[model samples]
Target: MKIVTIFVMMMHITGSLCAQVLQDIKLNAPDMERGLTIMKAFGKRASATSFSSKDLSLQDLSDLLWASAGVNRPENGKRTAPTAVNAQDIDVYVLMKSGAYLYDAKTHSLKGVIAGDNRKMVSERQTNFANAPVMLVMVSDISRFRGDDTEQKLIWAAMDAGIVSQNIGIFCAGTGMVTRPRASMDTEGLKKLLVLSGTQYPLLNNLVGYPNE
Candidate 1:
């Protein structure tokens, strides 16, 4: 007769998988000018940094996810990043020192997933993922596409992920956070680890954290 919230059960598994209580919180609106942020991103777009030991707060994590793909126009429910035909298939899953969460763009909140401090497994070993406190794993659910061709859906997914991925870079640059988006992942392996659905395909892993001196 266990009665615990999904988040609590997914943040820590220290002999109590369902011992914690976690829920989504409202994200803080970014306090930067859009045009200025874009300009700054373009300036250092090529000089990306990665592998940092600094960590980000939950609020910082919330802000980054929202900037990357949260709903921008609530009237029409448009996202920060554009999707092909507005499919909006990309899903941003965040890995923090605490746990992993699936970002819900519409609500601008995080849905807890795997429990325990498994964020390190989000990327391959010998990579900079360990240094960064947050890693955004972009996944696209092809079922959202109207088309039935799996191959075509995957292509569209990649394109959609690219746009969202760049948004992370731009946001990090403008906000003074460091990020490095990389495709160096074993898609199938990660899918299994995350227990992703058959139609959901991971696109890229964007590392985010504070810069080191």
Candidate 2:
């Protein structure tokens, strides 16, 4: 009887902990009027070396995601970043202090993936970037491409990931935030943590935050 009672207590505690995990975040609509002109943004586009740990405002975060790859055309469900053959294979996973989330472009919200601060996994050897409030990890599921040529599919995946990363860079430059695109990260660790399949390859990431000035 005592053993059973203890087990029940443990189960209750576990349930409570799971309930405390990060929940889905409904992102705000993209602010079309915000940001600098395209020419000005291009002039200011530069990778950030240092970042502040302050959290981004909800509006800023929403706009950033939308500009990165969110569905710009709701009617056809097209994204801001173009993909080869309209594959739309790139998926953006958000790593923050609270937990990791998968961006659901259809709903314009962040779906909680796991309940932990896995930002370090994305930072890898670049410990300096671990402190950034948010990191966008771009993963490519090559299986989305309708082709038997694995090599060709991989090429298309790389190109699509690069385009999305560029959008992130331009958005940060146009706005006041800073970002740096990187190809380094703990791939194995992220793959396991995110429960990704063999076809899902993590291609790039961007550490975004306010400048550490």
TM value for model 1: 0.83
Q: Write the per-residue lDDT of candidate 2 for residues 1-213, one digit (tens) a residue.
A: 999999999999999888657899999999999999999999999999999999999999999999999999999999999999999999999999889999999999999988878999998899988899999999999999996999999999999999999999999999989999999999999999999999999999999999999
Per-candidate clashes, comma-separated = 2, 0
Which lDDT tens digits does candidate 1 get at residues 86-137?
Answer: 9999999887766677888877788777655556566676354566788899
- Prediction 2 global C-alpha lDDT: 0.95
Alpha carbon lDDT at 115, candidate 2: 83
RMSD of each: 5.6, 1.6
- TM-score, each model? 0.83, 0.95
In angstroms, the error of model 1 at 31 is: 3.0
For each candidate, what is the lDDT? 0.77, 0.95
Best-fitting candidate, measured by TM-score? 2
